[model samples]
Target: MRLNKVVLMAGCAMAIGLGAVSARACEIKIGATGPMSGAATQWGLAIKGAADFVAAEVREAGGLKVGDETCQLKVVTIDAKYTAEGGAAAANNFVSQGVKFVLGPMGSPEVTGMKPITTRNKILMFSDSYARDAIGKRWPLTFHMGPGPAAWGDPIVKMAKEEFGIRKALTIAPNDQAGTDVAEVVAQVYENNGIPTKLEYYQRGTTNFAPIVTRIMAANPDVVDTVSTPPGDAGIIVKQLRQAGFKGAIGRLGGPGTEEITRIAGGLDVLKDFYWFEPVFIDDNVRALQKRYHELVGVEAPENNFFFLFVAGGRALAEAISNAGTYQDAEAVAQSLRELHVNDPNLGQGKWIGEKTYGIRQELSLPFGMGLIRNGETLPVRRSDAPTDE
Candidate 1:
């Protein structure tokens, strides 16, 4: 039996039941594995909700058009609990369930553990993790959804140089490979810009940051950069830094979870001297998407990095499948994804950009906004291109 061809006609979808492919639409499942519980639970929840939001939007558009077949997308999410072991188990379960495409296993460590299983199963993967070292030749089937560390670091360096006249930096991050990678990128970017940098590692899950804050004060750097610290930890660091009498600039070198971090730090007041990078402008267009997201999910969208990235990434994937005219062909979808120029409600204007570093045109090119929290609101101070090593 030939598959029915699905097409969008006059702003609606119709499945032509004229072929061996039945008119009855099939469901295409996209699996998401992440830390649904544990320290990173909020990140997991937001990403999952964003994926669902994308699915809901696609469904509202009368289902996804895949060549001649109209398919409905269903997101199947598994909790990885923010650990390598848990991620492996989740990937194994996904493989068993015959899930071909997966949304995320948020952390690089989690991806490292899950990659073997996902690869064995030939699953196409998308993630918000910015660990660039984890992508590239080794992981052929996986793609990094948003800007990585270099993307974050380069813009901050440009902003610091132009606006703050910053010359030195001190970085604090969780003691892990992700942290190490982020610190390395920022340090290199800063050093190349003629700014000396130092890095400090903290054990994950530490709440009282008094000692860390004291050490940071002693360093007396011009900028204190948090390298991929969780929202809660970033809050503590920011608050404690202020309390410890440090009056210098601060930068969130990773994708900053703005809302969550500000809330945890007691409000936007605590983020007064902070600067971070956002992939898109949160103008009226993006705000409308956030409103739609809240209405669909029954929760206010977190103004975090991955919230927008996941929504945009999910939409991009769907578009790729439609353009490739196949829901089951991962490589075709991957190729299509690279060629897309995205201008969605959530993502603004973007194009896939990383050909030199990853050896594939995979990274999304967008003007990253340098944001600052001032007078109780977060606003864009400047906008610049994401770091791409040509």
Candidate 2:
């Protein structure tokens, strides 16, 4: 009897040791892809920051449930170098590695490349591109993390007309897809409302906008609205407008409208009448997001698309993981994702923005807030959801 009792105690200890080993062995992998270098390096790095921060935050929070075990975050990053072929290859690579969810490149080319592979693998793709072509239409496994340029474009025009007292407008944009989309956004709304529009398009990198400036000056419209890419384009457009003696009203859709823009534009002094929508509004939601973001990244809150949208995206994915606990299946994750609120970044506050359909199938539009540079700061001009004629 003494020998049997000692044997039983040893067996119990061994079982406990094995169980601890099993618990410590589990891991989960998440993926993010972008261009990590070159002219667009800032955009790519911001995305990487959001993805890495979320993975770290989720891991530190004790990980996702997986069948009597828990797993920590294992983030996989692919550098597409901002190319279509590169993006397609990265998507295939992620699938080969058994990762089924991915965040795609922020621009049009990369998102276009990854679509096919994502659909085949049933990977849920979330993008930060401003192309309207991607939305108001559906892709099998693709989703948007924010409003399209078209979504915000028309509304800003209405604001320009009513708030700034302008009807007839002269507009200029680059020939790229994003620029075309922004111009179309304005035209769709303005044409429907019977407002006359004088529109012009240019190649992406033009050193002398003087010809275009001269033409717009000749038109002499009430508002000169412009939407272009990079800090360089906007800075030049605004600067040359003042330089070329075209003194009509100036409206800017500043994508590169970073704090850097005001400085690059020779100071906000030159951007007096420009307006751009804020990806994040100045509400409790944004403040709470900034706080959590600062806590995780050890820097000032990223004020661009990556900061706010990433927090929103991570919360959505985390809720899904928690709800689908103990089941690491892809279907389980996808289904649970639809059920999660994806609320505020504090991860403790603000309910998800949409109704039942938001989490379940898709969102009507990821929420956005509009703002204008007022008194040298981006001030909330109006809520993104403020009543409109839809």
Candidate 3:
């Protein structure tokens, strides 16, 4: 009797082990890589939050349907630290784990670092970098999360000129590819709009901007634009600019971080004359998206508005994975993504653009907003249509 009982128990244990293995086999892992530490941590967190929320949504609906099997969606995140080496390391980590899809590596340096690895490993990536070559025909598996300043800079520059009557502008950014690429584009736009502009660069990781502020004040620019500067650094520049009594309109013709900038510079009153590019105009639909995130993910979403953009991208990726019927086959998934209509329930209609600029139509073009603060009073964001080749 004892020998029979031992035999039955051994069989049950083996069956349980097999069941666990089967369960793991059905899990689909997606990676979220970005600068999860330092000044740009907010952007990385937004990417992670979007991935987690999408995974939660899939799990709530009984997992993602791929062919006949319902596969579990899992998000694996790594901190790229806003560096080239960090981004490459993150990609290698994903490759080792058999993760075929990745969400971000938010900076230009990070994107530059990860591109070769992602392409070589056949990992499909959706990056939110403002680099000139962020999306190209060379990396067909990579897609842009949103259009860079090349699309929206002109409109914002025109608005600033009209509102603030700025004649001369000085743009400041870190002395690196990430900063120069965006600053040059924005400076061109300002000049196109009849505003003479000067380009200034500071070494990265410089905490004190008093020297830079002194140079800017010496130039006596009617407006100062912080293009592609991290929010933490930009805030210090703004505070010192104000302290030095250099009262000119301040513009962020780069990524949206008005809230953080405002906080770091003290408050809205300190950002007396400010304008920026808001990736999404918050409305009822956007608010509903945030509420859904809280309900599904059980926490408040990241404060940066970039969260919405990542959410839209994440949903599209999930849909493509389901339609492709195989997450392991990233090429098939990329093809399906290329055919997908850029429509998010919350963000509404968008389209793929960037053919004229990047030689590929892989960039996501969505409605954007121009934010303003004049005389220390905040104004509602004004919406603009998505940019086209025209």
Highest TM-score against the true fold, candidate: 3
- The best candidate by lDDT is 3
| Model 3 Cα shift for residue 259 (angstroms) | 1.0
Q: How many residue-pair clashes does candidate 3 contain?
A: 0
Score every model by TM-score. 0.87, 0.79, 0.93
The models' CA-based lDDT, in order, is 0.74, 0.60, 0.87
lDDT of 2 by residue, 62-138 (tens): 55554455555677888866566777888899888887666656766667778778777877776666555453234
Worst ten in a row by lDDT for model 2: 1-10
As for TM-score, the candidate ahead, 1 or 3, is: 3
Residue-wise C-alpha lDDT for candidate 3, range 228-264, written one tens digit per residue: 8999889988998999998899999898888899999
Error of 2 at 31 (Å): 2.5
lDDT of 2: 0.60
Work out candidate 3's RMSD over C-alphas.
7.3
Report the Cα lDDT for candidate 1.
0.74
* After superposition, candidate 2 runs with Cα above 4 Å error: 1-24, 38-40, 81-83, 135-138, 252-256, 325-332, 345-361, 364-367, 374-380, 386-390
Residue-by-residue lDDT tens digits, candidate 1, 1-390: 011223443343344666443344567888877778765777787678778887777665667778666677788999987667887998888888878778887876778778887777778888766566556766777877766756556656777677666878898988876677777777788888889998998988799999889899999998888867877788888888987888787787676577777777777766676777665655666668778977766777755556676777788788888888887777777888777767765556776655665666666665567777545566665766544555
